[model samples]
Target: MITLIAGGTGSVKIARGLSKTVDDLIVIPNIADNIWLHGLYICPDIDTITYGLAGVLDKGRGWGVKDDTFVFMEQMKKLGQDHWFTIGDKDLALHLVRTNFLNEGKSLSWVTEWIRKKLSVSTTIMPASDDHIETRVETQSGDMHIQEYWVKNGAELDISNIMYKGIESAKVNAKAVEFIKNSELIIIAPGNPISSIGPIISLPAIRKELESKKDNVVAISPLIGNKAVSGPASKYMQIMGIESSPFGIASYYRDIASNLVISEFDNEYENRIRMLGIHIYKTNIVMEQSQDEIILSNYILNIVNKA
Candidate 1:
């Protein structure tokens, strides 16, 4: 089985492509971006991967169901509610269902599986943990949930720290850990290393498992040159005193990954990353269209197959 550690739009795009090529693909998505809003539980990364794999994602917006209406958001706005985090009518239905299930004392893994089967998704998508670990951003303004920092404030503030609340005491999902242990290859998908993939790997058990299987782990850099493909990954990296380049990405995953996949645009960092003892694979990593996603996925698969 191929296990992909996923979060954010970039990772979801990768998941979409891999789902087509591999039947035993398992996606372990980060739940740090989850939050409670409008009295409903929202899992951004999980839902994005689900919608994407189910072939109902809004490609243009990169999240939520395709052609979803915003009537619920509009109604919230009319009621003087803070609707900065845009939740469409269709998207709200998911949050409502998740919230109800959680309130009924169902484990997050169970709820997620139900949702996946309900959508007729064949690929396995699991949360990194069933625990309530939240990504909290510490900025000059004050601490706020990652959703507020990224969505409400547009991630404009310089962050001082990122805290994964509840991670210390949280248990890694046993099934996810089992998959990581038994998988033929483990891939760290291109996403925000700090907030997206960070929380999952921060767990002691999860990190230990990856460290044990370090040689089989491959990381796809979320960066092209010094800029991120999307989101505030570059900003977060810089704020945390790490260079926002392919070299920096190599350094960040040096201890956990044996190979690093970088964009051809970042060939200048090849020697620097190699100096850190990582095998580098240079290719056109940008997935601007569906064809690009497939090409990148096939490229990675070819590398693994040859190994």
Candidate 2:
């Protein structure tokens, strides 16, 4: 069993690859990325995993379903609706089904499992918590939804603060906790610390439980050559007033994590990371495309085997 803290495109691919090999793979996707637009819920991170595992993902876009139509949005535009966040035709079906299940008072975790089951995905996908963990980004203009800040607007504003709304009340899924307790390893994928992995680790209990079993814990650095592989991870860290380096990220997770797997490009900082008394596994971290993903996955599995 593997308890994985997952977020974004890279995390989904890593989780999908691991699911094929691990006996019981449990994913706690960051719910802080959840948002409601035009009165419907959208979970980018969660659905990215689902769509990828189900083999319906748009390979080119690296997210959403393949051959998915956007006629819904086209119609919305004709009706004078502002389609800021574009949801494809087939993808809309998922949102509708999930929102309906949630409206019936089912927990978000339960709804997520149902979605995976309907799609016949083998991986055990779960939300970070059943509660609404919305990410609110305070910018120079005002507070905005995470998707608006990242997708619609391209992080054009200076981020004043990044908050996880409802996280204090968020509760981890029971199965996720059990997976962590019974896992042989805890592998944190390369993801944005501020907006991706941070939200899931924000829950105190999760942090406590993980720290208790830190011997098998390992994290992949999202940075290569002091820049992010994708997204605003470097810029986001700077705005959040954190340095963009493998060592700095190590400092952030030092309390709960025991080791880091940095990219080959960051060899110069390995000495600095060693100063923190944590072991480092150096390799190529960026999954430029699908082949890079497969290779990185195998490399990490080898490290796990060695451990």
Candidate 3:
């Protein structure tokens, strides 16, 4: 099976393309961006990938269901409720179902599988962990949930540290570890390494598994030049004391990934990344369109196939 570690919009784009071609694919999404809002469970990353795969995603907004109305959100606002995290009517329905299932004592992994199947999504999407682990951004003002930092505060604060609350007590999802250990190829999708992908690898079980299978692992750099294609990945990288460049990404994944994919725009860092003993593959990594995503997916698959 081809296993993908996915989170964030960039990762979801590639996951959508891979889903169309790879029948035996498994996607492990980060649950760190999950939150409880309006008495409902909200899984930002998981829902984005689920909607994208189900072909009902609002591509323009990069999240939520396409053509979904915000009447519920408007009504909530009229009631003086905090609706900073915009939830469309259709989007809220899924959250409601998920929350209900959780209250029924269902594990998150089980609920996620049920949701994917109910949406007619054939590709298997699993959370990194069933435990409640949250990503918190530490700033000068104070520590805030990742959603609050990004959506409520517009990600404007300078991050001093990032903490994965509940990770110390969290256990890696067993099936995720099994997939990573036995999969023929492992792709670390291009996402925010700090917040999107950090929480998954922060678990000792998952990290150790990847380290053991480093040869089969390939990481797609989120950085193009010194900036990320989307999100605040560059800022987080800098806060982590790593340069916001492809070279920096290579250094960060050096231990767990044997290969690194970078954009042609950042070819200057190819030699630098290679110096760290990582095999470099340069391409037009930006996927602004579905066709772009398909082409990149095929290219990466070919690279692994040849290996």
Candidate 4:
């Protein structure tokens, strides 16, 4: 099985494309984006991956259910609710079920797998941890949850610190550890390195386990031509005083990831990136179209298979 550590829509796009070409795919989703909003447990990354792999993702937005309506969010606003993070009616269904299950003492991992099966997704999707590990961003204004910084404030805050609240106590999901230990290859899908993927690796045991198999890990850079395709990754990187380029991405993953995949358009930086002692693969990393995603997925699989 090919185990993928993924978060955000970019990674979901990769999962969607890879599913068409590979079998026995297992996804470890980031739960830092999850929040308790409107008395519902909202898991953005997990839902994105599950919906994308299930062929029900909103292609235009790269997240949420296809053609989902936001009548529920509108109604919540009429009731004077803070509905800054819009959750569509259909999308809220999953949250309702998840909240109910959690209230009933079901684990996040169990709820996630239940949702995946309900979505009819073939891929085995798992959460990074079952604990309440929230990603808190300390901005110039003050500290706030990741969603508040990312969605409500439009990610315009000057980040002073990024911390995973409760991560120190969060244990790696048992199934996730098992999958990583047994998978033939491990892939870090393109997404925000700090906010999206950082929380997953922050779990000490998970990081240690992954570090033990660094030789089998390959990371795909989220940036293309020195800019992120979507989201506030570029801005976030800049705020952290890190270069928002392919080189910066390679540097961040230098220790855990043995190889990096960058866009063919970024081939000029291969030499500089390789100086970090990480192997580089330059190809079409942008997923603007399904065919593009498929080609890139197949290429990565071929590289791992040949190894």
Candidate 5:
């Protein structure tokens, strides 16, 4: 069994690929991105992970369905609707079901587990907390949901602060903490440094649990060539007065993660990261177009086992 901390497309790809190589796959998805829009409870990160693992993801955009029809959206547009987020018909069904369950007071963990199993997803996925922990970006312009800043505006504004709104009240699941403590290895996948992965680790128990098992924790860098391959990691790091380089990433994981892994192209920074007292591994880190995610996952598995 392998426990993965994940959010959005990139970590979803890692989780999907790793499932093929590991039995008892346990995914700790970011719960900070959940939103209630248009009377539907939408979980963008959860759906992305579930769809990607199911092999029905729209590869091009990394979200929504493959070649999914927007007829429903077109109809709404024709009716003068001004929806900010794009939700496909099939995708809306998922949100609707989720909303109904939540309205009935079911926990997010229960609903997500139920849906994943209904879709025949063999791997087990869970949220970091059933308690709400909304990620808010305090920008110079104003406050925005993490997704609105990262997706809607393309991270154009200057960010002043970033935080998980309700994380103080969130509790790390006992099972997740147990997995973290007793697992042979724990991997922090290359997701957004702030909005995605940060929120999951902010829970007091989770952070303390990760600290307790620092020896076996390994982090994969989301940045390559000093820029994030996807999302607003670079922007957030800069806002936090931190550099967005390989060494910068290693510094962030200093005490929490004992090992920091980089890509083959970033081999030059191997020694720089090592100076931070972090064990570094140089391998191909990008799951770019035409690259095999499974093969990449296998390489990562070997690294973790060796750690």
Candidate 6:
């Protein structure tokens, strides 16, 4: 079985692409971006993967259900709610059910599995942890949740500190660890390394697991030519004093990954990444369309097949 660690839009793209050609795949998504707003628990990463695998993702918006209406959010704004975090009508239904289940004392992993089954998604999807592990970005204004920084502020603020709140006390899900331990191959999807994959690896147990199986791990760099294909990953990397390029990504994952897949545009840095003892897999990492995703997915699988 193949296990993937991913978060948000980019991860979901790879998940959807891999789902078309691969079975027995499990995705462990970052939950640090989750937030509680307007009395609902909004898990952006989980919803992204769920919607993507279910073939109901809003491709144009990159998140939320396709053709979803924001009437609920509009009504909330009229009723004097913040509504800064937009929640569409159809999208709210999933949150409503998930919130209800949580209120009834259901584990997040259980609720996630239930949602996956409901959506008829064959690819298994698991949240990194059932506990709260919010990603907080300390900016010039103040420390705020990841959504506040990414959406409300347009990620324009210079981050002074990027922290994973509640991670020290957070417990890694056993099922997620089990899948990782038994996987034939592990791939860290192209997403924000800090905000997306950071929370999961921050946990001692999960980090240890990855370190033990580092030889079989491969990571797809979110950066190409010192720029991100989407989102503010490049900005965060810069704030952390890490170079905003494929070489920076290699340094970040060097301890946990043996191979790093980079875009052909960043071919110049392949030898530089190899200097860090990481094998390089060069390809067109940008997923502008479904075809691109399929090609990349097949490329990664072929590499695994050879192993």
Give the best candidate by lDDT.
Answer: 3
Candidate 2 pairs with clashing backbones: 69-89
Which regions in candidate 1 have their CA more than 4 angstroms from the true location? Answer: none
Kindly report which residue stretches of model 3 are placed more than 4 angstroms away from their true locations once superposed. none
Clash count list over all predictions = 0, 1, 0, 0, 1, 0
lDDT of each: 0.90, 0.82, 0.91, 0.87, 0.82, 0.90
Q: What digit string (tens of lDDT, one per residue) describes model 2 on residues 1-307? A: 7777888676877776677667677787877888887778889899988888788888778788999889999999999997878899899989998899889998888899999999988888877578888888998889988888887887788788898888887777666777777888888877788898998888877887888987678888888866887777787788788889888788877877787888887878888888887788888876666667677777777877887
User: TM-scores across all candidates?
Assistant: 0.98, 0.95, 0.98, 0.97, 0.94, 0.98
Off by over 4 Å in 6: none
How do the residues 50-145 of candidate 6 rate in per-residue lDDT, one tens digit apiece? Answer: 999999999999999998898998898899978778898999999999999999999999999999999999999988789988999898999999
Worst 10 residues of 3 by lDDT: 264-273
State the lDDT of candidate 1 residue by residue for 1-307, as single tens digits: 9999989687988998899888799999989999988789999999999999999999899999999999988998999999899998999889999999999999999999999999999999888789899999888999999999989998788788878899988988999999999998899999999889888888888889999998899999999999999887888888778899999888988888989999888879998899999999999888988888888888888878888
lDDT (10s digit) by residue, model 4, range 1-307? 8999999787988888788888899999889988988888898998899989888889888788898999998898999989899888899888999999999999999998898888888899988799988889998899999999989998777788888899988877888988998988889999788889989988877787788988899999999867997777777787677789999998888878888898889977888888998889888887888898789889999888788
Taking all chains together, the TM-score of candidate 2 against the true structure is 0.95
Candidate 6 lDDT trough over 10 residues, lowest sum: 14-23
Alpha-carbon runs more than 4 Å astray in model 4: none
Q: Using TM-score as the measure, name the better of candidate 1 and candidate 4.
A: 1
Screening candidate 5 with a backbone cut-off below 3 angstroms (N, C-alpha, C), the clashing residue pairs are 264-283
